[model samples]
Target: MQRKLAAIIAGDVVGYSRLMAEDEAQTYSELRAALREIVEPAVQRHGGRTFKYTGDGFLTAFGSVNAALEAAIDIQRGFGTCPLDLRLGLNLGDVIEEDGDIFGDGVNVANRLQAMAEPGTIYASASVVRSADKEHVARFRRIGRRQAKNIPEAIEVYAMHPDKAAPNGLARLLPARRLSWSRPRPTVLASICAGILVTGFIAAGSWTERAAAPPAAGSTSGSLRATAADSRPTVAVLPFDDLSAEPSQTYFADGLTEDVIANLARNRELMVIARNSTFALGDQPADIREIGERLGAQYVVEGSARRAGDQLRVVAQLIDARSGTHLWSHSYDQRIEDVFAVQADLTARIVSSLVSYVRQSEAAAAVARPTADLRAYDLVLRARGHHKHGGADRAALLEARDLYGRAVELDPRYATARAYLGLTYISEQFGWPTADAAELVARGLAEAREAIRLEPDLPLAYQVLSFGLAASGEYEGSMRAAQRAVELNGSDPDSLMALAKAQLRFGAYDEAVENAERARRLHPLAPEYYAYIHGQALYAAGRLEEADEVLAECTLRAPQDPDCLKIRAAVLVGLERPDEARAAMTELLRREPDFSLAGEEVGRRFGNSPLMRRFLSDLSRAEAPPSAA
Candidate 1:
C-alpha cells in the first residue's frame, strides 16, 4: 500500500434503496445518466478522479482539497432539480492506495461526514477547510466540532453557504489600502474599504488603477461632445470583473452587470448610459474621467464578482466621474440566486447618491422584484443578452425565444420570463423578414395575457401586454394596459417607452411626447425607437422644427431603422427639404422593397390620425414608386 495525503470525496443518493425498490429500471437509468452527465464532468473539471462507485454513490480523490470541495459543491448545485437528492462529504488526510482503490481514515471520515450532511450540501473536514485559499475559506460556514463513530478525536466541520457573511479573517488579511483604485468621498471611504475586504477580491488585487488621475482638458471635445452636453446626471456601469476560480462563471458576472444596468435604467430622473457603450470599456485600466467624458456620463459604477463553492460575493462602488471620487459602495454576500436583489440594492444606492429628492415610489420601482425562481431568472437574463446581440443573426432571436420558453417551463409562475417571451415573439414577428407577423402577434398576445394572469401586479407583464394588444388592433385594451403599466412603474424606461408607443398609436400626441422624453431621460442611450416616437409625436402635434431636430438625431443614431427612416422622411418633407426627403424614402425602400403607405401596420393603427394622412401624402410627393405612394 502506498500512503500519501489526498482529498477524499464521498457522495450518496438520499433514499436510494427506496427509489430503486419503487422503480428499479427508471431509478437506475436516471442515476446512471446523472453520474455520467453531471457528476463526472464536475469531477474532471476540478482535477478529481472518481476511483470507485458504490451502487448509488461515488468515491473521488483530488490532489488539492479546494478542488475536491468545489467539485462537491458543483455536483450538489447541479443535482438540485435531478431525480435523486445527494449529500456530499470531503476530508483531507493520508490515504492508502492499493491495486485499484483508495482507502484509509480519510475515506472513513468522508463517509461519516456524508451521513451527517443535509441533502444538496457539501460537508468538509477541518483539514479540507484549512487547505483552501483565503478567498475560498471566507465562504466556509462552520458546522462545529463533532465526534464521529470510529474516530478517536472530535473533528471540526464546515459547510459551504454561498449566501452567508464572510469569515472574520477576511478583513484582517486585507491591507488598509488607500484610494489607489479610485478615491471615494470621505463619507463612504471606510465603507468602500470594508466592501472590498468582504468581497474576497481585495487579496487577489482584482482591481486596476487609472494611469492618470484626471483626464486632460479637451480630451472629450470631439465625438464625446454630444454625450457631455446632456444635462441630466448620466451614469455608466462597467462590466464586473469575474474572480471565480472556475472560468465558466464569467457569464454570471456579465449577467449581474446587466441586471445593475437594467435597474439603473428604471430611474426616470437619471440618464443611464446603455450597456453597449460602457461594456466597450472592457476589463482594462483607464482614467475614470476619460471614461465619463467619452460616454458622456457624470458618474461611473464598477464592481467585481467572486464565487467559492456555493458562496458568492459582489463588491460595487459608485464614483463621481469628473472628480474621481467614490460616492457609495457596498458588498453583497449571497446565494448566487439572490444576485437580482444585490443589483437592486446597488442601483438604488447609486441613484440616491447621484440624484436628490428621489420619490419613495420611484426608488421602489427601481428594485421591483422580477422573479423568485433563480434558474428561470438566469435563463431570462441570458436570453436578454442574446436578444441584444441578435442584430442580424436570426439564430440569436430563435435561441433567445427558446431560452425564454425554457425559463417559463421551469417555473410556470415566472411572469417576467413569460412577459419577455412575449416581447421576443413581437421582435420575431416584426423584425427583419417580417413574415408571419400576424400569426406571431396573435401568439405573442396570448403569452402577454398569460403573463399578466400569472402575476397581475408585475409592471413588465402589462408593458408587453400593451404592445401585443396594440399590434392586434385592440386599441381600447391596449391603451388601458399601457396606462396600467405606467401607473404601476412610471419610472421604468421600458414601461414608459411601451406606453409612449401605445399613446402614439392612440394619437395622444402630447402625452406620447411627454412619455418618450421621460423614457429618454431614463435611458439616454436608448434605441432609435424612443427617439423616433418622440419625433413622430412632435410632428403629430405640429411641432415641425422640433420634430426635424429629433428625427435627424434618430436617423444619425440608427440610419437603418425602418421607423426612424420613415419618420426622418416625413420630417424632411415637413421642413421643405425635398432632396433629403427623397433620399430618406429611397433608403427606406431599399430596406423594405414592398414599402407602401398602405402596407404599414402603423398606418393601419393610426388610420384616422393626421400624422398618418400627412405621411401618406408625403409618400406620394417623394415620387419613389407607385408602391410607396
Candidate 2:
C-alpha cells in the first residue's frame, strides 16, 4: 500500500436501507438511476474516479479538492424532483492505495462526516474547505465541529448551504459548540382575580433590554461546539439495575437512582447530566467511551439496587469514561431507613473525588437531613420520580403533587418536600388549559414563599421562588432570588437557568448568555426552555444568526413546544427569512391557535424594552395576533 495526497468524497442515500426494505425493486431501480444518471457523471466530470460502491453509498477520490467538493454539490443539486435524498462528505488528506483499492483515514473521515450530515446536505472537513477554491469556500456555512465515530480528535465541519448563499455566509467567528440543554417557556399570566391581591412588588423601570457590552469572560460556543475543558467536570448517572426479586421493587430502584442524581446535582462544582439523557440509554451494554462521547460526560455513575425482606443492598461505582478507569466503588448493606444516608454518602464521595473546590458550606448542605422521617422521604422520592417521568403529564403531575403534599404532611418540618410540592404544583399548572392561569400562579407562589419561610437557607426553596416571582412578573426580584440560590450553591442548574431567564427579561443579554451557558454546561441535557432563554438573549442582543441555530435545535428537540417554535419563528423573522418564519408560525398556530404575543398579559410579563418592542413588532408583522402593539 502506498500513500498519496488525495481528495475523498463520501456519499450515501438517506434512509436507503429503510426505503429498500419497504420497496426493494423500486428503491433499487431509483438507486441505480441516481448512480448511473447523476452521481457517476458528476464524479467523472470533476475528474474523480469512483473506487467502490457499498450498497447505499459510494466512495470517490480526485486529485483536486475543489473538484471533489464541486462534484458533491452538483450531485446534490441534481436531485431536483427525485425523492431520494443524499448526504455528502468531502475531506482532503493522504490515502493509501492498496491493491487497486483506496483506504486510509481520509476515506473513514469522509464517511464519518457524511453520516453526520443532514439528509440532502453536504458536509466537508476544514481541510477540504481550506484547500478548495475561494468560490467553494464562499458556499460553506460552518455549522460547527463534531466528534465523529472512531475519530481521535474533533473534526471541524462546515455545511454547504448553496440555497441560502449570502454576501457573508457564516463568516462570524463563533465559539465551538458543546452539548447544552433547553425547555419551553411557561406561560405567564398576570393575576387580576378580585379578592386575591398579590403582594409581591416588581422593580419596574429599573432595567432595560439595552444591549450590554460583551463580557471578556464566558464562552459563546454552542453546546455542540464546547470542549470538555470549557466547563465543569460533567457526569451521568446511568439507571441503576434492579436486583430485587419482587417486581414492585422497581419503583424503589428508580427512586434510588433519582435520589442519587438529585443529591449530586446539588453541588454546582460537578456538572451532572440530566436523568432524561441517562435513562434514554436504557439497559443496553454500551462502551464507556461511547457513553462519554454521547453524553459528553467525563465520569459515569452506575449501580444495582436490591431489597431483601426489610434489608437493602446497593453496589455503586464511578468510572472515568475517557480512560475507562474506576475512580471509586462502594457497597452498602443497610436497612431501608438508611437509604437516604447512603445516597448522601455516595454523592459526597463522588463530588470530593471529581471536584477539588467543593465549598465547605455546600458540602455540609449537600448531606443535610431533609427529614428524619423515612416514610416522608420515601414519599418525596417517589413523587419526584413521577414528576421527572418525561413530559408534563397531568396525571403524573397530579400524582406527584399529591405525594409531595403527603410527604410534607407526614413531616411538617420538611422544607425540601415543601419546596418540591410547590414545584410539582407549578408543573401541574404549566400549560393546563382548564385552570385559571393567574390562580394557579398564585397558589404556586404561595407554596414557594412558604417553603422559603420554613427554611430560609434551602436552595430549592429559593429556586422555586425565582420561578414564582418570574411568574408574578417580578423579573428583578426573581433574579435576586436566583442569584441568592446560585451564591448558596453555584452548581445548581435550575438556579442558573432561573437567573438566565430573569436576566433575559431585564435585558441583560450578555449576562443572561453567560448564565445560560453555565446552566447548560451544568446540565447539558437541560430542559428545552434553557435553549429558548439562551436564544432569546442572543436574539435580544441582535445576534440573529447564532440565535437561529439555538432555536432551531430547540424546535428539533421539542417540536410541539410552542415556546421553541415561537422563538424559532422570531429568529427566522430576524434573519429576514419570511417564508421559513411563516412556515414556523403556521406550525405554531396549528399547535397553539390562540398564540398571541401582543396580549396585555404578555406585555406586562415582558416589560417595555426596545428589544421587547421590536420582538412584538416582528411577531405582529409575522401575522401573530396583536393585542395592543
Candidate 3:
C-alpha cells in the first residue's frame, strides 16, 4: 500500500520508572484504560491511525495536523481523572512500508517533542503546526521553539490545551517546595517561644461590617484571568526530597530547600509554593500532575539534599511537572553559609535557560510585590519558630507573632506573613492567651488589619479575617471576609479550603461544599483542610452518611488525630450509634477535657453542627468530664 504524508505523534510517560516503583499495578491499569478510552478514538476522529502500544506509551499518525491537534483536545476532555497525565508531540513527515511499524524524522521529532511538552499538554513544531490550515484546524499559541537533533536552526513550538484545542485560552500551573520551620534540636524551639511574648493581641481600632468593601489586594481569585504570568514564562520550585542517613538531617536539608525557595521567590517571574503547603510532601513521593494541580504551577523544580560534615551537597532537577520528566539536573557543593548563595546561582541559570528556550516576551508580568525590608530567612525562621514549640505553648506563638510582626514591619508589603499573623491573633483566643473576649476580639482585628494593609492580595489574610470575625460573633461580617478571601485566591487549594471552612462558621452551607470540592480536586491529599471542610459541611447539612465517610477518610489520613476522632462522635449519634458516639467522645475527653468547653462555647455560632453541640453537651452532663468539674 502506498503511504501519503502524515503528521506523526509520539508521547510517553516521563517518569514511568519512578511511578512504577511507587505503584506498579495502579499506574499500568490507569494508563491502559486512559489509552483505550481517551487516546484511540480521539486520533481516529481526525483521520488518524493508532498502531500498537509501544512499551511505555504509544504512536499515532494523522493525515493532517489540524486533525491531530483536535484529537489531542478530545483525549484531555475525555479523561481528566486518571492519576498519570500524558504529554504529546506532533510533527509533519512521511512513513513507508518498511517494517510492521512506522519511521522517519517526523516520528523522531514527535518523540523528542513529547520529552519537551508539559504533562497533560500537546506541543507541535512549526513544521507540523503550519501544515494545519486555519480553516481546518483549531487554536495554537506558541510557547517556545526548540533545536532539534537533525534539524537546521530552532524549531518553533506551540502548545494547545485539551479543552482549548484552538489555543485561545492557554494557561499554566506551578508546583513548588516550602521549608519547614522545625529545627534539629527540639529544646531550641522552647527558647524561641519564651523569648517571644504576647504582643499578638494588640487591639485594632475598628472592624469591617458585612456590607463593607473588601480590601484592595493583589490576585487570589483562583481565576486564570489574572495568572500574573501573562507574557512571562512562569516557573515553580518544588519541594526538595531529603536523602540523609539521619532523619534529623531532614531539617537541615529542609533549610537548604527553603534557601532555594527564597532564592527563586525573589525572581518576580517565578511563583514559589508557600511553605505551609510544600512541607506537606515530606518524604512522600507525589505524582507530578497532582503536584501541578495542587500548586496551580506550570513548572516544578525538585531535588534531594544531604549534609556530610561541614560540607553539603544538594542535587536538584527541574521537571515540567505537567509532563513528569527530568528536564535538567545538577548538583551544588557548598558550605552551610554558602548554601544560600548556591540557590541564587541555580535560579539564575534555570531562568536564563527558559529565556533562551522561550520566545515569549518575558517569563512573567510584574506581579511580585516588593519585599526589601526583611531578610528572607527570617520568614522561614518564623514558620519554624512557632510550630516547633510542641502543642499549645503560648511562648512559641508569641515568638512567631513577633517574627511575623517584624517581617511586616520591615517589609510592609510582605503579604504572606500578614496573613499568618492574623491567624496567630485569632489562635491566641483558642485559650493560648489570658485575654478576655473583648480583648481577644480587638487584638485579632488589629492584627488582621495590619496584615491586609500589608498584603491586601493575600488570600490567607482574608481567611484570617474570616476566622477572627466569626469567633467574635460578627456572623455576616465573617461571611463577607470568607468570600473576599475566595475571590483573592480561588485557584489556591489551601485558600479555597480555608474560605470554605470559614463559610461554615457563617452558615453558608452551599458555598462551603462548592469550595471544599474545588479544594479537594486541586489538592487531593490535603490532610487537614479537606476532611474538616466537607465533614463539617455534610454534618451541618444533616448528611450523616456522607459526613461519616468524610470523617473516616480523615481518620485514615490521620489515625492518631484527636480532632478527627472527636468530630466523628456527632456523626455517629446522627446515625443512631450512641455507643460509638460515646466512644468517640471518650477519646476526645482523654486528650483534652478543655476541648469540650470550647466546643460548647463554639456551638452557638454554628447551629446544627452536631459535632460541636454534642461534644459540648456530652462534657457538660458527664460527671467525669474534666471541663465541667
Writing each residue's lDDT as its tens digit, candidate 3 over 1-629 gives 44667787886764567667756776566567667655775676668888647767888887777787777666655533334556778888766535466776667778878777766667778776667777433455544335656766556666555552323221211011211112222332332232121101100000110111111122122221221112233355655777777776666656666545544443323334544456665545779766665656556778788767667788888777667777788888777555645665666666656545322222222123235442544464446545531246777777777877777677766666666666666777754535385676677777777768875655567777877777777767777777666544333455566667666766777666666655553443455546756676777766678778878777667666666665577678768777777777776667655665654565353634544555455434432244444
What clash count goes with each model? 3, 22, 31
Measured against the true structure, the TM-scores of the candidates, in listed sequence, are: 0.57, 0.61, 0.49
Worst 10 residues of 1 by lDDT: 202-211
Name the best candidate (by TM-score): 2
Candidate 1: Cα lDDT at 93: 93
lDDT of 2 at 181: 13
Candidate 2 lDDT, tens digit per residue, 67-115?
A: 8877777677664324576778888888999877899999999999898
Model 1 lDDT at residue 519 = 58
Q: Give the alpha-carbon lDDT of every model.
A: 0.70, 0.70, 0.58
Give the per-residue lDDT of model 1 (tens digit) for 1-629.
89999999999987778767766777787788778766787888889999999999999999998788777766775564344667788999999999979999989999988877655567789898778888777666554455678988766766653332322332232223411122323423343343323322211111010011122232211111122122346678999999999997787888888777766665544556667556767655899987887666778999899977668899999899989998878899998767666776787788667655443334544465667777788788778778762255678888999999999989988887888888877766556536688888888888888888986656677878887777777766787798767544444657776777787778887777666665564454556676777787777777778888777777776787777787778778878999989999889898878787657635454535666676778766775465544
Which regions of candidate 3 fall more than 4 Å away from where they truly are? 1-237, 241-300, 304-316, 320-324, 328-363, 366-369, 374-393, 408-415, 431-433, 556-560, 595-599, 603-627
Candidate ranking (TM-score, best to worst): 2, 1, 3
